[model samples]
Structure formats: structure tokens, C-alpha cells
Target: MDALFILTMLVVICALAFDFINGFHDTANAIATSVSTKALKPRHAIILAGVMNFAGAMTFTGVAKTITTDIIDPTKLEAGSLFILAALLAAIAWNLITWYYGIPSSSSHAIIGAIAGAGITAAGFGALKAEGFIKILKALIISPLLAFVIGFILYSIFKVVFKNFNLTKTNRNFRFIQIATAALQSFTHGTNDAQKAMGIITMALIAANYQQSTDIQLWVQVSCALAMGLGTSVGGWRIIKTVGGKIMKIRPVNGVAADLTGAAVIFGASYIHLPVSTTHVISSSILGVGSAHRLKGVKWGTAQRMVITWFITLPISGTLAAIIYYILNLFF
Candidate 1:
């Protein structure tokens, strides 16, 4: 096989691998609230999340197309397959590092930053498509803030509405409600997160001249969805613990509120074909709900630590990608 074809294959594998890791990493966020609230048993939650994620992944290609054509044009990238490969490698490395440490970092940021970094390294700063890049950054920054606001407001309303109700009965009712919300959250997670890998694969196809245009092929979608589904089954216990319990003591009511808030923000972003970090949105939702429910109950220390990690992920992943690109370029 020609070098280009081989490189394309490598990109496809790496992209799917990224999706798989993303599934377990972020799927934890989708189901953490439910599991923590005892709304679903851990095994049941994983199964539900895996199925929902697959269903959601197959539902949209708009975000994938955005990732493919935006950031930096695959059409204009020379030897771009190498850049993408380095990006995939860097993103995977960052994700694994965070996963090992149980930090709920953004896989979306890692890949996007890696792509930008690799592209910049290959062709300098001019390689970036400024408008699209800025738009994505806005979505990433704004979604978590939106999630926080919605979560705070929603839980405040819940408190007022259920104030007169029996506490035990209310928790029971909300626990049942959390089951549905968990599925919705996972579905929404699938809609946004799975598309990133799809975009990466499409970029590879274009860069290698295997395909033209930003349209995602059916096989690519199916493969990515399956990879993610399988990954979800593995579960991300460490990150799950941080998001589910360390952020706050999540009651069923609190879980439902956070779940609804995260689902709304994520689905809204997916509707507009924007990629946002599921980890950030979900974690922020919990923090918001905790603050609304009881300010002192919120773990500001843990929140501060997670926030610091979030701010650093972009630059760190980008720099790491640039470094990997140079090293990979040396070999190929």
C-alpha cells in the first residue's frame, strides 16, 4: 500500500480509539449523577449509558462536518494525515493521563487543541481558520456557564416546588425520574462527543484524497458509535467518583436537576452543531445545583482544582500535539 493509504488507515484507527476512550471518560459524567443518587445500579447505568450513547452518536453529522471543515481546512492541509495522527496520539495521551489521575478533563479540548497545534506546527499560525476556531472556543467556554446557570435556577425551582412535600417521598420520586434523565444525558453526550472522532476521520479522508467534501460516510459513523459504546461498558470509575460524589453529596433531586441541566445544554449545543465539553457541563451542573441547594455543601476546593485543570487542558494539549508532530515528522 502507498504511504498515504497507510497513514489514512492509521488515522482511522486512532480516531476510533479516541472515540472509545471518550465514551468511557465522558460517559461517566452522563451517568454519574444517577449512579451516585442510587437511581440506577452501577452496572445498569453503564449499560443504559452505552446504549444511549450509540443511539445519540448515529443521530447527527453536523458537528462532525463542523470539525472536519472548520479549525483548519483538511483540503488545504499538506501531509495533513501525519498532523492528524500526531494530534490523535497527543489527545489520547492527555486523556489517558487525566483518566489515570481521575481528573475530569475535556477530551473535546484535547482533540481540538491537538488539531490546532498540529496544524500550526505543520503550516504555522496561518493554518488555522480564525472564524470557525473562535466560534468553537466560544461554545466551549459558554456551555459550562450556561449549564451552571440553568442548574442553579432549575434546582432552586425544584426546592420551592417540593418544599411542602415529604422529604423521603420526594427523594424516592426524584430517584425514579433520574433514570430517564440519565438516559437523556447519555444520549445528548453521544450526540456531541462522538462527532469529534467522526470529524477527525473525515478530515483524514479529505487530507488523503480518499474522499472529498466534509460529509461523513455511514461506515465512519457506525464504527465510531460502536467504539464509543464498547468504551462506555468499561466504565470510568475514578472520574465518575469525582464528578458524582466529590463535587457534592448528590441527592436524587440534585442529580435530576444536574442531569436535566447538562442534557439541555449539551443537546442545545449539539442542535447547533457545536462541540462542548460534557465533563465541564456535567461537573458545573452539579456544582451549580450544590450551590443552590446549600452553598457550604459545595466543595469549592475540588471545584477549584477541576477548574484549573480545565483552563490548562487547551494549551497543554496543543503544545503536546505540536511536540508530537515534530517527533512523528522525524520518523515519517
Candidate 2:
């Protein structure tokens, strides 16, 4: 077999693996609140999320394009396959580590940082497209903060609008409404997160001379969607526990607000072809809602830990990717 062919296959397999892990790892982002609030049974919520996520993945390719060309040009990098493989390994490691710990870290941050680290290590600072990389970084940083503000404002509005209603009746009504919002949030997650793997696979194709245009092939899209959907079926119970309950005692009204904010922010990023952290956005939305509900009700300790993970993930993943690239280059 041709060496490039073997490496390309490896990239595809690893990329899909990353996508699979992403699905289970971030599944909590979509269905956590609904499950916590008893708005949807856990089994039903996962089923809904899996189907909606697949549908959402099939609907967009713009973010895939960004992942293909923005951070580093696959065509220009030296030993590009090794670079991508190292990135996948590093990202997958970070993801599994965080998921095991039940930490709501950013998968978006992990993959992006790993790619950047590997690229720079393989080809130096010049390998990066400063303009596009910076743009992506900004989106990652800003979106969660934006979600915080949006969630805060939306919940505030909800409080005033429903303040006159009977509490029990309102909670009962919002529990039903949360079902729809949870599905929307999951769909939005598919629109953005699944594309990361698609982008990685497309970049591998380009680097290995198996493909030309940055346009995502039909096979790539379907495969990524299936990988994510299948992974979603497995469910990440640890994450569900952390995000659904640890962040705050999620009420139906709070869940609805957070779901709306997360969906809006993720979909907005997808439309613009920017990748943002769904984990960060969803968690922040919940935090925002908690703050709105009552300042003290939000568990500051758990939120603080998650925030610390977000800040550290990028640099650590990048460094790991760089080290992994160096080691892989020794063999491949």
C-alpha cells in the first residue's frame, strides 16, 4: 500500500473517532437540562438528540470549510498527515480525560488548539494563517460570554413575564416547552460540532492528494453524521450528571432559557462558519440563568472549576499535540 494512502486512512479513522467521542462527550450540552428537569426522560432525550443531531450535521458545510483552510493550509504543511494525526491523538486524549473527570471542557478548544500546535511545530509560525486563526480564536472566546449575557437577559424577561403566574403552573408549562428547546439545542450542536471532524477528514484528503476542492464530499458528511449519532446513542452519563445538576439546580424555566441561549449562539456561529465551544456556551447559559434566578443559587465552586478548565484546555492540548507530532515524526 502507498504510504500516503495508509496515513490518509489513519486520519479518517482517527477523525471519526474524535467525532464519536465528541458526540458522547458533549451530548450533555444538548440534553442535560431536559433530563435534569424531568422535562424529557433520559432515554427519550438521547433518542431525540441523536436524530436531530444527524439532521443538523447534514444541513451545513460552511464550518467544515473553515476547519479545512482557516487554521493552517493542509497543502502547505510539511508532513501534514503526521500533523493531523498528532492533533487527533492529542484532542482525543484531552477529550477523554475531561469526559472521564466529568468536566465540561471545550472540545472545540481542544481540537483547534491541537491543530495549531501540531501545525506550528511541523512548519513554524509561518504555517499559520494569522488572520483566520485569530478570527476563530475570537469566536471561541466571545461566544460563551455572549451566551452568558443572552441567557441572563432572556431569563430576566421570563421572570418578569411569568412572575404574575402561579409558580407550579408555570413550571409545569415550561417543562413541556423545554422538550422543544432541548431538541433545538441538540440540532444546533450538530450544526457546529460534527463539522469539526468533517473538516479534519477533508483536510487529510487534501494533504494526501486524494481530494482537490475544500468542498465537503457527500460521503464525508454522512459518515461524520452517523459517527456522531451513534456516539450520542451511547450517552455520557458522567457529563449529564455534572452539566445537568452540578452547575446549578436546573429548573424547567431555567432549562428553557439556557437551551434557547445555547441554541441561538451555536446556530449563529455555525451560520457564520465559526466554531465555538458548545460546552462553554451551554454551561454559561445555565450559569446566566442561575444568576438571574438568584445570585446565591448558582454554585460558584463548580462554575469556577469549569471556567478554569476552559482557560487551560487550549494551551495544554496544543502543547500535547506538538509533543505528539515530534514523536510521530520519528516513526512515520
Candidate 3:
């Protein structure tokens, strides 16, 4: 293979690696509530999440197409092996840092931010699409609020409907429902998250002249999904504990409500080809559920910390990617 071919292969591998980490890091988003409420054991939840995540990837290509063609100008990116390597490394590094700290950071934002930073460093600000960035910004801003409202309203309705029922009976009933909700959440997760990797891989392929259009191929979708599913199976235990157990004590009813609300928001976003953060959705749903009971039930400190992380993720990851690209340019 030529040097360009090898570098392209490396970029695909690294992009998939990021997808795996995306799954591994964010497993807590899908199964955390089910696991916390004892609706599903951790092992079983991970297995189920992994399978559905894989299955979800087979469904669509619109989001992938958007990422590859609309987000950044392909012509402006340096068509060099080292540039790709640096961008991937920057994403991976940011992923690891947040994962280690057990922060529910946005992997989607991290990767996009890294690409933007690397692209700007290589080709200047003109390389990015302002409209595409605005779309992403809108998703980031709107998704959590959507999730919160849905979760709050759904939980409130549940409370009202079950007002006369025994609490134990309600919990038992919702435990069964949580199984379905968890599955739906996993499906949405796959649809949204897997497409991101597909987008990156498709971009790499376009750069390498392996295809004619920026559309994602079926194989790319399958591979990205499978990689993410496998990553979910391995699980991010630290984050799992943080989200599932530590945030608030989840019961079956609240868990089901949170999962359903999150699934709905994510599914809506996916249908619109908007890449929203599953982490933000789930966390906001959890907060909504907690606050539905009373403000005191939600842990303000933790929520504040998570919000701070959310605020910092884009800039921090972007700066990191820019620095990494600068350094790699020295040697490559």
C-alpha cells in the first residue's frame, strides 16, 4: 500500500476506536437507570444494550451523510496522513481524560470539536460550515431541555395516574415497562451515535478516493455499530456507577420514565439528522425525574459539576486537538 493508503486505514481504525470509546464511555446513558432500579442487572443490561446498539446501526444513513459532507469543507482539510492521525489522537485523548474522571462529557461534541480545530489549523476558519455548526449548536442547546420537559411531564403524569395505587405495585409494573424503554433507548443511541463514526469514516474514505460520494456505505454503518456495541459490552463501570447509582436512587417507575423520555428526545433528534448528546439527554432526564419529586431530591452539586463539564468540553477538546495537530505537524 502507498503511504496515503496506510494513513487512510489508520484514520478509519482510529475513528472506529473513537466509536468504541463512545459506546464504552456512554453505556451509562442507556442502561444506567435500568441497572440502578434493579430492572436489569449490569451484565445483562450491557449485553442487551450492545445487541440493540448493533441492530440500530443498520437503519439509516442520512445523519452520516450530513456529517461527512455538510459539517466541514472537504477541500480545505489537508489531504495528508499526519493531519488525520493528529485529529484522531486528539479525540481519543479527550475521550480518555473525561472517561477517567467519570465525567458525562459529550463524545459527539468532542469529535466534532476536534475535527473543527484540526481543520482550522490546517486550512483556516473558512474550512468550516457556519450553518452546520449552528445546527449542531441548536441540537446541543435544545436536546437537554426537550428531554427535561418530556421527563418531567411523563413522570408527573405517572404520579397522577398512579396516585391511588400502591407504590410497590407501581414499581413492579414499571419494572417490566423499563425493559422495553431500555431497549428503545439503546436503539436510539445506536441510530445517533453510530452514524457519527460512519460520518468520520465516510469522510476518510472520500479523502482517500475510495468512493464517489460522501454518503455512508452499508459496511461502514455495520462496522461502526458493531464497534460501539462491543465497547458497550466492556462498559464504563465508573460512569455506570456515577449515573446509575450515585446521581439519585432510582426506582423502577422513575427509571422507566427517564428512559422513555430520553428515547423520545433522541429519536426525534436522529430523525432530523441532528447529533445530540445522549449523555446530556439522559442526565437531564434523570434530573427531571428527581426534581419531579422535590428539588431537594436532586443533587445540585453533581448537576452543577456535570453542567460545567458540558460547558467546557467543546473548547477544551478543540484546543487540545489544535495543540496535538500543531505538534504532529512538526514531525509529519
Best-fitting candidate, scored by lDDT: 2
Residue 223 lDDT in candidate 2: 100
Clashes of each: 0, 0, 0
- Worst ten in a row by lDDT for model 2: 73-82
Candidates 2 and 3 compared by lDDT, better number: 2
RMSD of each: 0.6, 0.7, 1.3
Residues 1-332, model 3: lDDT tens digits: 78778878888899889989999898668998998888988899899999998887778677787778766766556664455566778878988998999988888778778878777777788887989988888898899998888888898998898889999988998998989999999998998888888988888787777886876787888889889999999988878777887667889988988999999998888898888889999999999988896678787888888889888888877788789888977755
User: Which stretches of candidate 1 lie above 4 Å from their native place?
Assistant: none
Could you tell me every candidate's TM-score relative to the true structure?
0.99, 0.99, 0.97
CA lDDT of every candidate: 0.94, 0.95, 0.84
Give stretches of model 2 more than 4 Å off: none
Candidate 2 colliding pairs: none
lDDT of 2 by residue, 232-292 (tens): 9889999999999998999899999999999999999999999999999999999999998
Ranking by lDDT: 2, 1, 3
> lDDT by residue for model 1 over 1-332, one digit each (tens)?
98889989999999999999998888999999999888999999999999999999999988998999889886777888999999999999999999999999999999999999999999988989999999999999999999999999999999999999999999999999999999999999999999999999999998998888788999999999999999999999999999999989999999999999999999999999999999999999999999999999998999999999899999999999999999988888
Give the clashing residue pairs of candidate 1, or none. Answer: none
